[model samples]
Target: MLNTGQNLRPGSQLFSSVSESNHAKGKYYLGNQQDGNLVIYPAGTIDADSSYWSTGTSNRGLLLTLSLDPNGTLWMFDGNTSFTKTLFLTNQSSGAAPAVENYYCLTLDADGVLRLYSHVFLRLEGKPTIKVAWQVPGDRCLVKGVCGPNSFCQLTMTGETSCSCLPGFEFLSTNQSTLGCWRTLPISGCVRSNNSSNEETRMMATMVEVKNTTWPENPYDALPVTTSIEDCKLLCLSDCACQISMFSDSYCSKQMVPIRYGRISGSNNTLFVKVYTYRAIQRKKIAGAGAMLISGATLVVLSLVVLSGSVFLICRHKRSLRYMRAPQLYDCKVDGDIGLQSYSFQDLDVATNGFTQELGRGAYGTVFKGVLANISKEIAVKRLEKMAEEGEREFHREVRAIARTHHRNLLHLLGFCKESMCHLLGYDYMPNGSLANILFNSDVRPSWSKRVAIALDVARGLHYLHEEIQNPIIHCDIKPENILIDRSGIAKIADFGLAKLLIGNQTNTLTGIRGTRGYLAPEWSKNTAITVKVDVYSYGIMLLEIISCKRSMELKRAGSEYNISEWAYECVMFGETKKVADDACIEEAELVRMLKVGIWCTQNMPVMRPAMKSVVMMMEGSKEVRQPPRPASFSQS
Candidate 1:
């Protein structure tokens, strides 16, 4: 196995061994054998069942060595010669490659999974941060023999895979559960017997029903009876040889031990496992007796307490009835799981300190910076000035959509307040303010690297809204003023007042001209149906602004007036792309790549522009950015 301090170099071989580390001993091994193949296996054994992943370079009958590059590329070469043949490779593409000082190594983790890890030294933290650069069988549950036979693999709420034994079964090795499990009680109903003594013992066996679970092992008997789930459960319980029964769509299958390939499934499959019921019966009897004793004592106490509180209860009921009969104030449809709190107008008024400290103003509302009295945490409260234009339903429809969205790059909606016609929204305060403040109004300009990161941040946020969610959202407005920077220097997309959600099977909507003039797509002026590409066009315009640190409409060079998109096209055409973002420290290739992406996005036609997903890939250097065609002379509609 590879060690913590060592990285696999060219012509090096890895042997299976136990090392002192945080991992459990004797569960994993990585071997770059004499053959060309590089494989991972369960420690102490090498078999079809124990092996999980390999480079698939084996069977070539040539000696191969594994090597990891600084860019997180893993490849194998044949023999130790200048003219070496490459066999297998995997690449991890990111914004930039890791530094030479960073430690990169491949390890067969304790969980029987293979991973390429990079330990980069953080200068400010004075310690190295470990990151997983690559991994095989990305879903850990897919690793063969990870949980072994008679046990199921499950993904917990925390996103980790765990092994769980079937009902009435226990782990064979508690310390290392991957070894599998065994039945706690001896098998009794394997063979049918007519003896009366055995009949009662068989009746004692009960079926434990579980939903959304499957054991894909071949069944000894498959019954295609179109019966209900209850009937299937009873059939498995009465069978002499059946250990587990799987039922789906009225089909029943009987499986014998040891059952293999059990996992939590998304389908509506029910698993019924036969378990020893003696212990369960005893526990239920004890619990029932205790419940009866407690109920008898509680009843006497409740009788006395009720007599004393009768008068108080009547008075409280009358008071509540009077309040319930009073006039209703407001009504707003809200989803319980939207992750937004419904605050009264009075509460927001107090939270914003009577709307005194103005943070900023937008097309829909004015934002105020305030510290919540209850939590003593700062918040940005936007009091919608034009709430009267759009009724309560429209305001809440936007709120519900915004609250349902969650991404690291997207702004989080904390809560909302509605009082009759008054409407307001609360958000986590962004201490660094909007991108407009940092770009045009600040004394010091941000570095090229930070600008590139911010552009990517906005692209990812837009991608989440456009493609990642169930109902795609078009952020009609994409501008610097709407992109806010948090305290940690991360940019978040905000202001969803003009955001439009495409309902089921609805790709485009006919809406009036929306968004700032310079950022709007040509479709807006043409009075055509609006799609997500409009946001892409706006993002493209903003991308150029982020690179040049200049506004789109106000861009000029050496006293010559030019649109920012037009100026960028001219720079790229004349082999002067360096002028777009002239930073001495940044790579020219990355700079040119971003310029091309921006140009492609700003194409006049909606179909000509690349989607946000493609833009993000090109900006992150994962996808090659080809040369873009010339944008229309009129960049904005």
Candidate 2:
């Protein structure tokens, strides 16, 4: 069942076996049931136990298909139906679904889990970069009976699990504890019976208390009547079968042999275990007490000597530390819009599999697919080609600003990794990837409606960055490659590497030709103050590409060389507006209106460019947009 893009059509199913990472061993299927609920179950399932997971997508006569987008989005959609779904394997993959489903996978691990993995499959380049987008039992604790009975399991934030034995008990083995713990001290010879005539057989026992520890368990035996700590201790001590006694808020839980235990990281409960004292155990050998005392003193003196020598040697040894990057690092909330998950270089290494799979390449660096193990979250890790301290400072500033942004249209900064000469950034993976992929590479062309929708989504996000935030952000490079789409068909602003943040009320200017060649604003070429209008101009170019599905680099007509903006204007006026657009079903009025806005955004004068806010309203048909004069372009004539 190595399905690349299997369409689980409405009323059909996608099945997988209970073993292996491939569906060949699968007994499970993600089905669109009659009740509108898409469920994962074994074949011939009629009950709840047959299901592993489900999507509640039910309609009387709705049609939908389960697909994985190019950027690793697992989606269920019909574009024409209410049954459309936008599901993410990881929040990083929270962008527009593919225009048409592409390469991705559904893996059924032998560990009894169903997961969705997506790969950016480039047939020509022959690079298949796979990423785990979504998975089941994401939490290690959620696994059934992961720790053996009678042992408490502790789950770390790094996705590692540890098992521990209770006091007076030891694990059956160091590696596995599925069989539970074995008792260290037996109570049969410790507690005395009144009917037993032999007084020498009686032994005194001591209770060892473990503090701030709790195990979550379905108590097979409990004593609600034990209103005090002493009562709970007495109840357990009276019964030799009780291995551990837990007391919390006057409630007592006694676990017998083969206990089911799990450790809560921040618990306040206490577990007390009764064990026979050394004096009690040696009662039968009282005649040799003097000799035993002498031996014990000698052992104590030897132990102190060893402890002192170990500390002296440890102090002389130098230490080197390397952090093991984990998912917990990326879970920090810096501000409202940003969550900075700081990861170790090693974490990124593991996530990207040594950076073997690359999603895309840019002037700054390359981005690869990564998965956070602890939370089972998929993210895109951008590894910079250069890690200068100055660049690192700039990255930090950008992250701070991006984190404060909280809009659906903007790509969020999930986390970052910094170490000696290595700098990486983590972002929610966008399945649709960049707009360039849609307009240039893929055959799954976006319809006129989808193009318009994407234009509006990008507008809204840019509007937030330019107008809503405290400090206006000037995106020096705003192009199709910088615009990312989520599974929901909404677009978002991404790639802040060249983003410039305005400080206070002062208008600060920058130098140098910054953006991609074709989309760079004229102002960038001129020695003048850069403004948010630069982004406005680039966006206009991108908007046109969305409509025409062509690069806006250069266009010529009537044997005269001119820019795309000027060429588009001439075509629209001659009643050839349809010819100016890519082949798609679109109403004449909408096409004309969209074209007019694109023209207005590309106006030669910076003052003529409408703000992103205005762009959004015009695209959404919420504001009246007037027709503009032909946009002037840089002609070589």
Predicted candidate 2 versus true structure: per-residue lDDT over 313-349, tens digit per residue: 7765423113434332333234422345677888889
Deviation in Å, model 2, residue 212 alpha carbon: 57
Model 2: lowest-lDDT 10 consecutive positions: 497-506
Give per-model TM-scores.
0.52, 0.46
What is the model-wide C-alpha lDDT for candidate 2? Answer: 0.66
Native RMSD of candidate 1 (Å) = 23.6
Total backbone collisions, model 1: 1
- Candidate 1 similarity to native, TM-score: 0.52
Q: How close is candidate 2 to the true structure, as a TM-score?
A: 0.46
